[model samples]
Target: MIQNNLEKYTIQLPKKLNFVLKKIDSNSNGIVFITNLENKLIGSLSDGDIRRGMMKNQVTKYVNINSKYINKKPFFLNYNSDVKKILSYLESKKNKKKYKCIPLVDNKKVIQDISTIESLRKYPIINLKIDNSEINNVIDAMKSGWISSAGSFVSQFEENFSKYLGGGYSITTTSGTTALELALKSLQIGLGDEVILPNLSFAASINSIINVGAKPVVVDVNPKTWTIDCNRILEKISSKTKAIMPVHIYGQPCEMDKIKKIAKSKNIYIVEDAAEALGATYKNAKIGLHGDCSCFSFYANKTITTGEGGMVVFKKKKYFKLANQIKNHGMSRKKFYFHETVGSNYRMTNIQAAIGISQLKKIKSLILSRRRIFQYYNKRLRKFNYINLLPENNWSTNSYWLYTILIKNLGTKKREKLIKNLLKKGIETRPAFYPFNSMNIYKKYCSGSYKFSEKIANNSISLPSTSISHYDQDLIIDILIKEINKLI
Candidate 1:
């Protein structure tokens, strides 16, 4: 029987360990993790736990055969215990269950389980704040007749974008998808080449690679940041590996510093799929600064919107020229109607740029507004008895385009029901992006069991994150709590 108060050690259940492992399926090793309420890992449960529980019939047959079972007995180790002692304890626990790891109860515990999937499962669902004041600037630009993509507003938008990233040349494109294609084409990465990316990103990123006749080597994500694990890149790297596209997912920036070094060592190109990350920075350097070419999305739901637009930024002057020409349908010299390269029409209209320019000017305020909403929701929703707030660290600035929250103990089916209930109350909520590996078109290209992705995918829902009002927040929160309580 489990003791309420463990003397030598205090055995406590993890708040998010199960959730984390659900996001990143156990590797072949079959080890599960445990973390505290703050998301700090306390210990691990091993395959042995599963085997023992099954042998003893401690777990229900209907329960997943793969799931780990925690021993009711308190497992404890002193904080001062060394690695060897910790290993000994784990070995001692080994039996028919074949458990290989035991987690420490406290920070001082000898072996805290940091290896579990739960330790890495939390990510912040942000609210990308919009600047209300920038609206006036855009209105002024519009009234001044600078309402097209080619006007001074476009230049201002590009200038502001570049300045935000410490000075990179920015070329506006019509959409995020087109922006990626523009980047790939400008970098000369096409047929006979392979571009490696995450199966977790928006399909647009993958589609861009395929559009250029380049094969996409899709890999799973880290389940922590929901970004591609850099280690996996080498396994897929080949002579045909022309570029590595690490998508900055869910307002979290990819580990660009390490990715850059690896790409350099392999002599491959790095393309920043910053479509979801407009104001996000990496090591205070900003995202687009690292890639050979970087892309941003200005879709309605993005950090900023020009209704339907995107931009490609780069340091290379040649790409700027190529992108400009390519976005203009391959026209170089108007007099001779010179077509320098085969390209398509992917230009953002001046009208879109005009709005974008206005939006850009108001980015800081918008970010702050989103942050405010995030803090409020984080503070309020997290206090609930049956909810788990996704985690976010300060490594990168998250522009919360959508606010995500994990409904504790509820599966996807239940989450769907919750969404239905919220909809009835006029409260809008969304699910995080579906696992890309599950998509029919990309299944063949996907490798590995996206256990973590599948698990979180089931229980998670995104809340409305529009920069509205505190009143809206309170109403949504009240409705959500009421609906969830009824179900819980």
Candidate 2:
């Protein structure tokens, strides 16, 4: 087996032979990497080199205390080298599996990380499903010459989305961020207002609050659902708290009932950031209806894609009207350029809406596929007891936007290495959103520690989750199983 203990596998040149042996364990198969003061990799020292140095000493152990048998020309990979290339290089070596770990170095040869062969597999993670239907719809919209911001397809997209979600007004926007901005703006959240949000969410959720001139009150997330901690929101709420932007992160619902009760009592509005959760339902109720207004993203990677678009779903016509006015540069539907209020140009194109309309038609099927993908992954991975697959409470249905797993005892460094390895094999994996407190931009605003968010961010890895062949999934699982075995 490759000795993965880096502390035992790295050293500097001219170290005392005995000391180096003790450090790397003279009998161990581990090799010590040597670096200069600038942390540039020079070479690697094997245990055999140490034994040979001892043998070369004419006076035996008393003759020389130093090692001169270093392999000055050791193999190392450039940092961020594709996993596939590294695997090809390793397969050519004698001990293919054991020699798989390679030092990833910068241009100056400074160590960045390590990649292993087991983590690199040929099976891909996710595949985008854009076939004839998407193409046909876009072409038809384009040929009609109504591909601009306003068109019949835009209304059709909004109508279809609302109908798909069990009835609510849907206001399409250029992007998810714009949709969120419109929702918050409709609620009148501006200067001196605070929006309670989970620190574990994507950057867009946080940015929208800042975009609306509202201070973001960072709250910890629930470890189980990886959603906003409803309990934590109370302590962060103040007189200035205007809204709770609960992001249904990675296709799971937050404790909506409890959060709704809290919001109702505090008289604070809720703007559900359902960017990653398009079709998820909480307690038999679709997500869009619970909040004062909910937002959905149709970014290429979401459960459904409008290529680049989002929707603000409103329960009340007033909010929808306000969002529509804001989206169209304050232009009223009746009188064009009859400026109503200071607004923005966040309108979605008819071309995009046409695609969205087509995509929304298959929303139910798409979500079912996502859930099936999760279930498939869960079934294969559950036997690996140490892995925590994405959480799904009894009351909620997951959209499984990205199938996520948390490996116990794995930290950020190892998690990244694992991801790099997956990338080598053409499998595209991503780390979970880093905690808000972990980011420097949010440092000035963050008050207290977010313990759970930190833990989840460090340990989580997201698998590629799209429509793919069962064989591909099985191959992914097989390789993943092999890699997880090494983690223990």
Candidate 3:
């Protein structure tokens, strides 16, 4: 929640000058909003305003603030107003240093929340999950003067990560994309091979396939799960099909049992893109165990972070060895600096792995926090018929990575408008990743019907989740309800 920044600070009217003085002095940015009986914003008072008013009244800090002290017409922006105009207005006020934080209000003059550069800096779309432990480890690693790929922490991270994902062996890589690239290369899937994947995923999934020179076969996703339709995957397989890359989108695991069965029968390899689904499970078993190789991301926003790292977890020691060689310039294990085949330098650094180890220790708590946040949002969002929140189906446990939702009857443009409205209130949000077929750069790689994926992409919104203030989430939901009612 980034609690130290005082994001929810507010002052009530009829408050005395003593309190106002203390508040303005103690507030994070030397300012406070003055609200009326209904919590409706009436004005604001700054530290300078308090001092000047005290001088004019010839009174101590005991006098009431509303008695000719408050700026009753303090600058504010409507929730649905253009964000550029609000920021421009704030920029103009910044020179005075009078309005470091601006209040955003609804038409009813209720202060939804205050927007401050400091508070905004404190919290972001997906706040970095690092803490003091990770920081200390990073510092210690630097002191040891071993910040490169070849350090003890890298091996430790891989071993611990493999154990965490259920007794598998793991190889660390520079990024999630390379993890997928290494996994595919280990499977010997390239050029003449085809890999089927859902369209409702980040471009990294498709890019990995293309980088390995394997043709990407796109399939539609189930609207409910927002994952590849298991029924659709089997139909996409051809004699050239070598593997299936099922993405665990937005923390929800795909129908792995069904996909695994089909892949097993066809002798096709399975590569699970569990990048966003760390700590999630399918039927009480962790997802990484279901595929031949499961790839995870440690991007800053993921459930855990290594700043910029990824992992390839596999059940077989042989597959781990293959991935290791592929990422290490295809060098033979017995020969020093001897290359056996073509490969890439995709090794993850010890510094990143050090952070990953610290972050991983808190993965359970982090995932639980996200799920609790989802529960908080779901209880409120479900009352609205027009909104549909993501579900934790019986077959899988969701990590609630993004806590996304779909707005009924709202196309891409209106959903965009909705996002803009939220942004105007300084609440960050994101749209669903567009279907691969819809993205022009990847269009040539995708040739399939993606009606459901396209629809979900257009109508969905990834709400503010992660470690966030419930008070802030309440404000966000309130503002959302208000703006959505306007649209209706």
RMSD (Å) of each candidate, 1 decimal: 21.3, 12.4, 10.4
Candidate 1 lDDT, 1-488, residue by residue in tens: 01111111222353344443343243444554444455344554554665686697665533332335663343555432343444444454533332333444445343322211121111112323334555565677678775655577677778888987788899988899999999999998899999999867778999999999899998767766767778788888988999999888767788787788989999999998999887877777777888788899988788788878999998888888888888777887564577888888887776677778778767887777777887789888877867766557677767665677777678767777888777655456777677777779878667776676665566778886754456557757877888888876
The best candidate by lDDT is: 3
Best by the TM-score measure: 3
| Alpha-carbon runs more than 4 Å astray in model 1 | 1-149, 333-336, 384-386, 485-488
Residue 3 of model 2, lDDT score: 22
Candidate 3 per-residue C-alpha lDDT over 1-488 given as tens digits, one digit per residue, 9 for 90 to 100:
22333333577856566776677777667788877778788777777776787688754545444367667788876644444444555666534434577776766788765666533322246756555899899998898888898888999999899788778889999999899999999888999999999999999999999999999999999987889999998888899999999999998899888998999999999999999999889999987889888999988888888888899998788888888887999999999799887888999998999999899888888888888888899988999998987756788888778888888878888888988877666567889998898878888767668888888888888877866656657766888889877775
Prediction 3 TM-score vs. true = 0.78
Can you list the residue pairs that collide in candidate 3? 18-61
Candidates arranged by lDDT, highest first:
3, 2, 1
**Candidate 2 lDDT by residue in tens digits, 340-438:** 888998889999998887787787788787777788888888887889888867999877788889888789988878887666555777789998888
After TM-score superposition, the amount by which residue 185's alpha carbon in candidate 1 deviates from its true location, in angstroms, is 0.9
Backbone clash pairs for candidate 2 read: 83-424, 84-424
